[model samples]
Target: MEMGAENKVGTIKPEGEIYTCPTCGYTDGFHVSFSALKNNRKAEVFLICPNCHNRFRLGWHVDLSNT
Candidate 1:
């Protein structure tokens, strides 16, 4: 199987601010940030699931405290 348009975001479990992968439900993964939004307040990251190796393009709400 390869990554294509079919590999998109679906169901996401609302378990606090921690965002999990919608495809494999993995709690942890590698993130690659490409773009920023809202004056660098938020960012778009390529989240790769370690469990299933599924890649997801998701919007990440930048944490102000972390900045």
Candidate 2:
């Protein structure tokens, strides 16, 4: 499907840091960032399984230190 400006960051941000199960297929949005979340400095990618209602978070480090 086509991606909009809000969904162009390559990550899905939900209201609360609640993610579904990755084992199940469920193409829906999930929460990644929360309050005082300093550990995750990079962008987290949430991918829902199409077959089962599963949610997976891909934590990436946006190393701007080199820049």
Candidate 3:
């Protein structure tokens, strides 16, 4: 029985959204992806702070379509 990290399955898709941290100019593309299946069954976007290397997750969804 080998349960490795690579065996993890993600259901989320990256919509190419960039979020800027207020504390710093850390701009990281927030990829829309799935995490924690049971208690947390919601999709989230993550942004890594370049300055402080802090990981930020925006728990909100926004339509980036022109329409």
Give TM per candidate.
Answer: 0.37, 0.27, 0.33
Pick out the ten consecutive residues of candidate 2 with the lowest summed lDDT: 1-10
Task: Name the regions of candidate 2 deviating beyond 4 angstroms.
Answer: 1-43, 61-67
Decide which is better by TM-score, 2 or 3: 3
Clashing pairs in 1: none
- Which digits, one per residue and each the tens of the lDDT, describe model 2 over residues 1-67? 2222333333334445534443443435343332223564444344544454234445533432334
Against the unseen true structure, what C-alpha lDDT does each candidate score? 0.52, 0.39, 0.42
lDDT of 1 by residue, 19-59 (tens): 56666677764454334546655554455566776665544
Error of 2 at 60 (Å): 2.8
Query: How much is the lDDT of residue 46 in candidate 2?
Result: 43
lDDT per residue as tens, model 3, 1-67: 1212333322223345456555455566332333333344443344445565444444644443355
> Number of clashes in every candidate structure?
0, 11, 0
> Worst lDDT window (10 residues) for model 3?
1-10
Which should have the higher lDDT, number 1 or number 2? 1
